[model samples]
Target: MNNAKRRIDLVLLPIVLLAAILNGYGIWNDQYANSYYTTAVGSMLRNFHNFFYASLDSAGSVTVDKPPVVFWIQTAFAYVFGLHGWSVILPQVLAGIGSVLLIYFMVKPTFGLAAARISALAMATVPVVAAVSRTNNIDSMLVFTLLLGSWFLFKGTKQGSPWRILVAFALIGLAFNMKMLQAYMILPAFYIFYMLAFQAKWRKKIILLIGSTAVLAVVSLSWAVTVDSIPESQRPYIGSSETNSVLELAFGYNGLSRLTGQQNRAAGAGMPNAADDRNNRDNASASVQGSGQTGNSAPSGNPSDDVGMGEMGRGMNGMNFPQGGQMPNGGEMPNGRDFGGGNGGGMGGMFGTGEKGLLRLFQTELSGQASWLLPTVLLGCIALFAGLRRRNITMKHKEAAFWLIWLLPVGAFFSVAGFFHQYYLIMLAPPIAALTGAGFVAMWKAYRERNGWQAWLLPLSVMFTTIFGWYIMQVYNDTIGAGWSISELIAGFLMTIILIVMLNSSHPWKQGMVIAGFMVMLIGPVYWAFTPITYGGNSMIPAAGPTGSNGMFGGMGMGGRQGNGNVGMTPPNASGDADQSFPSSSSDESDVDNSGTGTPPASGGNMFGGGGMGAAGGRGGAGSRNEEVDTTTLNYLREHNTGETYLFATTDYNQAAPYIIDENEAVITLGGFSGSDPVYTTEELEELVQSGQVKYFMVGGMGGRGGNSDISNWIVEHGTEIPTSEWTTGTDSGAGFGGQSTLYEVKL
Candidate 1:
């Protein structure tokens, strides 16, 4: 028996390590929606505090929406890898791995081996969980801390030990330190629900509950207390004042404003009426409407409703600029201009003033945000009552009561949010994973009675279906968010129906349903992730027009500089405009600058020019000039025979330097000659390829800011833009005349 148990342990340990290893691996470029710098910056800032009690305030402030736990994690990486990319995120990868192991162990004791394994695998690959791992945020780590808290709480109750209580409280505190109160609320809420529903011994439950709550209060409050005790200058940017302000914003202005045309989060974008109504009335607003607590509607003759065009005139829709509001002449407003108040003149009130009364009301209504889990949170509260009242609590029910209480506190915290993202769903999964795993284990006799041998079909079907479900969900999410093709949507829909049918049919149909479901869900994601089908076969490259107008920089940023684009998913440009595709970003010069050539400086990193975004990186002011491309670009020429990278050739800071330096990745300017200037001859451009120095001659097309049509004539004369004679040419490409841009690659 001992040897058999040892052999089983050997197999299990490897599985746990493998899952954790994959969980901790590096995130790709797109998972962050192409924004790794935010976490990198946050890590650097908090890492500063990890060393000393110092105040930091200067040179353009940056703060994330959450707390310092994530920063601390990255700070650890900073200690190991220095403050930069990939390394700082390595710890999270480990936490992710740890989470998988924790899930397996937490469930294993309750659910038995099979269910625990499936639970581990299930949490590891779920779309949202996958996203959290790939992101540079706190969700994954929070999931870890929550898992730890839940496990130890279960242990304490089961073993009649206070050490486990300390561990649980410590985990709660760590989670609180990580992302503020969300973890605190989310976990405890779930624990309470489990306790009340099952544990009948009220008095002992009460004692354990109070003991755990007291323990949690002490554990979680230590950091806040320590930070609070510090002098102002010492821990300047490191506490929870903004947390309340943001909650006010979320529940007050951002929340209340959404009811009418007031707090539109996407205020300026001018979503189509249909989409806007659907978004506003469909998901968020619908709940408010159902509750019958929605506020007053905007009056027809309200002056703010009569708002004009320009900055102030920017209607409730935000896309609307004020008519006579700002610049009377209709041009740029002064620097740091405030669109304060509303459409008329008073502050547009995005986040209204934080009156205590209003915040209370907001918090009250906002309590319903996590309504789904509140009742459960309450039950765990009762279970705590039973534990505390006990004299001799040696039963399994008493132990389950402990886990129920611990988890409830954390779960209820996030449930209070007005909105929930996939990351928010993180807290729920671990407990559910454990519950599902363990519940299935405890109810084996029952499930066998309820499902019998057919019960075996349950997991097999869910596994196969979940794999399928993941694909369909990806296509649906990617397409909707990224706007993929009509044909792609049709294919996705068809596959979804097949999977739905397979899952819903009777017993005999289960096998066929599972198989067919798997095939359909597998289709789009696999093809998109792996194939050259190009953004779901819609030609990531735009179709050519009859006017023979090739687009800017061949076919690069037009695909997307963020989100889906970074993931090789090209954005849609239905308006015939190159700019309005995927993830609406401010054409902020910084975005254009960073997206173009110059490398982003390392933390606290000032640029060295050629397009550096350091303190003097040509970001602001009237006409500053400190841009420089990478020094590597000067010598980083690559072999083109294998043809891997794309290039944009330019010089003259005032001309193409900012845009091309990072965007096209300048290697060498082709002909028209000068250092970093257009210099290579067609033959020289070709020779650079032979020398493994250049692959593209990145020249000018119309709308290109500087330079000439010579590069254009050059491209047409020597290269091909896209494939297919009919659709490839800029002219006679059918009815879509003057509708597209052309990009020519020199075959040389």
Candidate 2:
């Protein structure tokens, strides 16, 4: 037994290492994985007040949109490691690795060693899972938490221990604090598993289920109740809630908005109307086209035309065509729309989730992320139940049903839900991994026994899944090259043929053929998983693919160029230092050092105080950079300080993130993230200024989400405007506030 356990441990070691390497390698290069959350981490480190609230700034002005559990864990890691980019990312990486191991342990006792190993491998290789785990986003941690709950739930059901079942629900409630309602998506599976597997009278089982639910409610609402009980004056305002209430924020923005496509309304009371958004988008499009360069620029007049296809396009072309393959008619190929941009059909498509339908998961925008193994999962479900009879239900059959229940509701949600990011696909990983692993073993046993139609199910499953993988590759052939699809097609067919031949004879390598068939199915997702490390991924969006410099889905759709926006157009200085250029409105390029250090050239006068429109600014917004507050600006703010509570005030979190991260000082964010939240009104700003809690106000940047226009106007009317030369280096590019930024000194 000890020797067998040692062998199992040796195999598990490599799988864990694979997950760790995929999630942690070169993470420091990102500097700030997602500045929004990174800023919150920095603020949380300042004091217990901000820490408890998950505040976005040190002043405890407003909490972040989600609950505090994940950030609380990240905060602990940051505190110990001094808050570097990798420090915060380390927790998620470890969580990701832990999840992989959990899958092995969960499946081994019931499904055997081979199934457990396969499940672990499937979880580790999922592209979306790895992509999200590499960043500071809460989804990876949320996934790990949910999986932990599943572990306890599974154990409790097997042992028929009511105490363990109670503990399982409590852990799930803790996961609710990690991501709100998203954690509850798996509850149906938990309830069904316990009801089917636990040994008790029907009435007694129902009563225990009710008691467990009561425990869930208590653990889930503990933090929200504590937070909402605090008076408005004592604690930070709920960041994304309409009524400054935690429960409202949870049920509204984080709950109903996820399914109803009403995110704009639930996000906050104030948002830019359609006309303003259209005008801004139009102006941003014109700026991109007028200047021949593209780097983090916003979408153009047609949102579909804004696909950024620079490096990935070239890479694909090099792979497919011996001589450089150019799009016919000067970089114009078929219009495949933006890979994951634009509202393809509905509100969900706006955030790159693709249109709502049965086929939504299979669409190119999402398929490469987590759906590659879905075909196997569906066929494997059939294989698992092929020989089971209703009168002879077993624990294994009950467990199979548990995974199916977990998968269907969650998969159905993503299929039809109106709002979610691509990385949210991680929710589908666990069940798919488990079903694929367990089903493979079941199918293999039937094949060896030659159990009628079940014998053919194994080969059919492999062949169909391989074909589906080939189709996914073909869909992206224009961007990622047809070479991969063609290679996989040949290999998959050869393996299928060999497996079929081996089934007819008492072949010694039949198990080897089965493993090869699984490998053939995995080729596409493995490549997709590796792309993030090969080409940098979007830390903000956390999608797996080649995103180019614009950091959206690049080269995954059709077309090369010839749009209002420079979708596939490479910048003239593509090979030069990225910090030297800014997306300007004029055709002539500025020689400004965009690192916010050097003075602007005399020919290119400072736009710091000018009315000229520059690029859209924010961490993941078009034309933005992950830059810190320049030394000159930091020095100026420090010198002018009058012991105010806040060092300065800005229109939104985008404008304030850099300063908070650089100095860990309080910088008031009038609006929440995206500048859309009605965090404060002009009257509140007046009160803050009068109380001497805030003295400096920076306004008129592209980052203003229009909710705080009144505050900007009030500052310009009453405060003294400091000249651009006072604080800014002439070449100062707004860290997140695009265009020109003006500093105003508001007096008492």
Best by TM-score: 2
Instruction: Check candidate 2 and list the clashing pairs.
Output: 296-622, 296-623, 297-623
The best candidate by lDDT is 2
What's the lDDT for candidate 1? 0.34
Candidate 1 Cα errors over 4 Å, as ranges: 1-65, 188-205, 225-417, 435-748
Off by over 4 Å in 2: 1-8, 266-335, 338-344, 547-626, 735-738
Report the lDDT tens digits of candidate 2 across residue range 1-748.
9888866667788989999988888776655556667778889999999999998777787777778999999999998888766787789999999999998999998999989999999999999888778877788888898889888888888888888889999989999998899999999999888988999888989998999999999999999999999898898878757788999877876687667645333224433345554454345423422332111112111011111222112112211111233323343222334422244432344334566788889887788889888877887778888768989888889888988999999999988776566778899999989998999888888888888888887888888888878887787576578888887888888888887888878888888888888988888888877666765454555566543221232232111111112122222322222222222210000000011111212111111212111111222222232234556677888889988889888754545766777577788876655444556777888999888898997664433333444455566667887766777766444422234456778996
Q: Candidates' lDDT values, in order?
A: 0.34, 0.65
RMSD of 2: 8.5
TM-score of 2: 0.84
Q: List the lowest-lDDT window of 10 residues for candidate 1.
A: 542-551
